[model samples]
Target: VAGDEDLPVNIDDLDADFDPKEYDRRMQQIFNDDYYQKGAEEDDVPEVSDEELQ
Candidate 1:
């Protein structure tokens, strides 16, 4: 299971003075990481044609 360490940031740490740019960068990084991981997993799955299903 994913843990807090896997998260980009702790929600409990955010305050009124938090920097938006930093937060955005962290979120983007997380998104990119997840996208890349998903793409990698997809590569392992074999592709099938419509004819194979018929």
Candidate 2:
């Protein structure tokens, strides 16, 4: 469960001169992934009517 390949990079290890555009792009990707995951989880649940519960 602890493979080196699966390890996340440390922020302190990043270059001091990292491009601001690259950081923005990476942040956008993370947000997109989170939004997609939430949508996918929501799709798995079934919606029931109030009448059905009665």
Candidate 3:
């Protein structure tokens, strides 16, 4: 998505001149929670709130 957006940092400029550690953090922060889920929802909540018992 290069040239698509004009920002202070260029993600692909790692070899050229850019702090990967800083950029990595920024990128993660931007997509944190909003872009992706923290983890599997099922891990926290059970598949069934209440299962039928025989």
Candidate 4:
């Protein structure tokens, strides 16, 4: 499944320092619907003593 006639290219290769802010915003908007907010809330809670990792 490897063909070069219509190859996908790296975005970074096209523009060495490209920052597509709108593309980023759209992705964040999609991902922010659930898990992102939940993660933020979880980060705010304190960890219990016995649950601490080695």
Candidate 5:
């Protein structure tokens, strides 16, 4: 669509320096932080025992 049509011309404009590792590391860090924070807050809630229902 945009300029990415099959109109190849020069190799200099090509972005062959793409890195997926950096992107993965950032996503993992954000996920870990959110998971730990939620766990800490939920620990205060009461839990029902197996025998409580009887």
Candidate 6:
């Protein structure tokens, strides 16, 4: 949760108007970032030792 991605809503930004589209976009970005991070971690390959080749 950084910058506008912060879960806590700001009274100043929502003083009068609430944009559902903007909110959805921000949430989607957060989810995508998390999803990619998980994918990158899973893509890592473990090194095999030569001794294990027997």
Query: How high is the CA lDDT of each candidate model?
Result: 0.67, 0.61, 0.53, 0.54, 0.55, 0.65
Backbone steric clashes in candidate 4, count: 0
Candidate 2 clashes between residue pairs 3 or more apart in a chain or in different chains: none
All-Cα superposition RMSD per candidate: 4.3, 6.2, 7.5, 10.6, 13.5, 6.8
Q: After superposition, how far is residue 51 of candidate 4 from its true place, in Å?
A: 24
Judging by lDDT, tell me the better candidate of 1 and 2.
Answer: 1
Q: Decide which is better by TM-score, 1 or 5.
A: 1
lDDT of 5 by residue, 1-54 (tens): 145343332443344454588556544754566556766886886879989968
Write the candidate numbers in order of decreasing TM-score.
1, 2, 5, 3, 6, 4
lDDT tens digits, residues 1-54, model 6?
354353544564457466888778755765676666866896998899999887
> RMSD, model 3, all Cα superposed?
7.5
- Model 2, residue 6: displacement in angstroms? 9.0
For residues 1-54, could you state the per-residue lDDT of candidate 1 as single tens digits?
A: 254355555664465467888778766876686767866885897889999989
Candidate 2 residue spans exceeding 4 A from truth: 1-19, 33-35, 42-44
lDDT accuracy of residue 43 in candidate 4: 80
Candidate 4: list runs displaced more than 4 Å: 1-19, 33-54
Give the RMSD in angstroms, all C-alphas superposed, for model 2: 6.2
lDDT of 3 at 8: 39
lDDT of 3 by residue, 1-54 (tens): 234243334545555556779678867765566334434452486455454432
Error of 4 at 23 (Å): 0.5
Span of 10 residues, lowest total lDDT, candidate 3: 1-10
The prediction achieving the highest lDDT against the true structure is: 1
Segments of candidate 3 deviating more than 4 angstroms: 1-17, 37-54
